[model samples]
Target: MPLRLPPLPALRFFEAAGRHQSFKLAAAELNVTPSAVSHGIVGLEEALGVELFVREPRGISLTATGADYLSYVSEAFSLIAIGTQRLPNHRANRPIALSCAPTFASRWLLPRLPLFRARWPKVNVTVDTSHRQVGFPVDGFDFAIRLSRAPVAGSAWTRLFGEQLVPVCSPGYLESLRDVQGTPLLSNATLIHVNAASEDWQTWLEATGAEHVDPDAGLRVDTIQLAFEAASMGLGVALGRRPLVNRDLESGALVQAAFNTVNSATAYWLVSAENADRRPELLDFRQWILAEAAQFSCDTSVDAAAAQ
Candidate 1:
């Protein structure tokens, strides 16, 4: 007997619409107009002989039938994706593309990436540095390192590391603020602020009881990397997130203006599409990254204990 199925295009439209519960959002996901999505769903409903959605002026909502059908449709798509990925490929040069924040990519991940390459010489890796949140499969990234207070929805998330905030500056910059008692007065120092992380400076100051320093007065930069560069050039002191400044501090290019470091609410997380674990290369990368993070965390703890 021949298989009975609705048109693949209509089913795809229905799945997107049902998942989002909005025709407009579904159209955006499918890169089609709302009218096209509406027409596709209409055809799908006619073929199925049932009402799938309840239309509203503000937006559409899936009916009980549509909600029930979506579960099965979603599972079918997952199965198809897994099967497709499992197919043998002659090409051995497929690269794993990863997205990360510019500062984290340059100051942290890139410095450590050579180690990964040494361990997995056969694997090809590509890194994209941007502040924008990755959309996983849609954005064509195999994995993403997101700095957020919480994990993003609709993906598998793993916590990589937490962050600490500290005021950092070049040695020359620090010396310029020394008082008669040989103490650096942060209140008299110029501040360099990261536009996206403006609160970090304030948070650190408040935690350290340095309320005399004005957090609002500073030269603002778009990224943490730029702020670090500005600070290194003797422009101003910057609130450096620990992970991004580790190498600089170790190399003596940057130093803590004060010994106080405060824990930050944000942390780095590794995220991938819901079914990305099915890919062997992705699994290998995940394991390697997790192990690296574990070792780094242990080293950081040891250093902190010694400092105390």
Candidate 2:
């Protein structure tokens, strides 16, 4: 059977007009003149065989039929949008989807995303927050920023950055703990830990040769963001990623508890299957990421050199 659908452009015009209740406002939003909006609405109404809006000096109002039909039109538009969004290659010029940890997405990738957009305006980028674990083809993901000790058994991995862990607490937490005398200020507050990095406390203790420090203590958090929030709320000390928390530190929302930090064996990696690795969009993304990583390495090197 032949599918009969209304003209998308005309439907869009009516939807906008109905939503704003003003042709002028709709025209402004659509970047068209009032005459264009009026013409589009008239065309839509003519095709539908019903008046959509009652003209008035004060403003326009929906007719009884217009109000009922408007609901269906709005709903139809929303469904069309969802269908188009998820359709493969619907974005036209660029269709790429990458998944990564939420904290990484917000703290690292989002700030740098504009550069990618400027460079490849036609390429559409979709970012999904998976909190560090994803299953590739099964998950409908093109690529993923994975955090692991090393390469997965059967998967190829490109090392992106090393893990650098440091203690952080809110400014208020530090001020409150500063004057208190007890079994060390740290013991008085709850320590926030990421459950994914289950052995983090033990690993830190072993590396620092402070084995006596209890590994099981304080508030346990399941995600990096939650740990950060807890620390920011003056709830406890949190082990934070230096790069991720750099902004908060600079802004004085969070402060480092100690200068010393441990570099863990685990690293953040860019992982994808064989087919995905060869994709043009993936290739472009990989090149962009590697370039940014190189810059970050150089910056860190210079900082370390200067500190000496």
Candidate 3:
């Protein structure tokens, strides 16, 4: 007996629409107008002889049958995606494209790329750095590094390392500050701020209970990198994240202020589309990156504990 299935386009429309629960969002993902998505879904419902969605004044929702059907359709697509990656030509000489924040790319990943390349000489990586949170498959990234406090949905997420704020400044600047027992008089020194992390200084101050420090009294810069550069020049103290400041600390350009390390709400996450591990390059890179992130986390933890 011949297999009975809905049209491929209709199925694609239904899957995207169902996944997003908004025709407008689904349209954006499908690179079509909202009307097109609505029409395609209507056609699909007609062909199936069942209403997939319940129309409402405010928005649309998946019916019970639609929810069940969507799961099966999504699973089928995932399987097909996995199978497509298995093609011989697909695995050969393809660079794993990575999307990440500019600051993270500059301060952390760029320095580590040499290590990744040495281990996987055959697998190349093309990194696109921006502050924008990119979409998988649509944005054409094999993987993305996101910094967030919340769990990622519609993708496979691997926690890399949590963030901590350390007040760091130059050795010269440190000598000028008065120390009370071990902790520095942070309120007396000039605070440096990164516009991107505008609240970080205030947040760190509150976390440490140094309410005396005027968070607003700081020289602001556009980026964290610049903030660090200024702090290293003895201008003011910049709140440095562990991964970003490790090199500076090692090089003796910056010293950590004697204060309680402020634990941040966010962490770095390695994210890829669900079931994207089927590709050899992605799998290899994922394995290698997870290992690197683990080691980094371990090293940073030890350092933090030692400091305390």
TM-score for each of the candidates: 0.73, 0.63, 0.70
Q: lDDT values of the candidates?
A: 0.83, 0.75, 0.83
Clashing pairs in 2: none
Candidate 1, residues 15-117: lDDT per residue as tens digits?
A: 7788777787778767899999999999999999999999988888888988999888877766675555556772335788899877788887888889988
- What is the C-alpha lDDT profile of model 3 across 28-114, one tens digit per residue? 867899999999999999999999999998999999999999989887876776666666676467678899888889888888889
- Give the residue spans of candidate 3 off by over 4 A: 1-88, 179-183
Q: Alpha-carbon error at 290 in model 1, in Å?
A: 0.7
Query: Candidate 2 lDDT, tens digit per residue, 29-108?
Result: 67799899999889888988999999999999889988898888877766655465457775445468888888988988
lDDT score for residue 142 of model 1: 79
Worst-scoring 10-residue span by lDDT in model 3: 131-140
Model 2, runs deviating above 4 Å: 1-94, 131-133, 136-138, 179-185, 210-213, 305-308
Overall local distance difference test of candidate 1: 0.83
* Each prediction's number of clashing residue pairs: 0, 0, 0
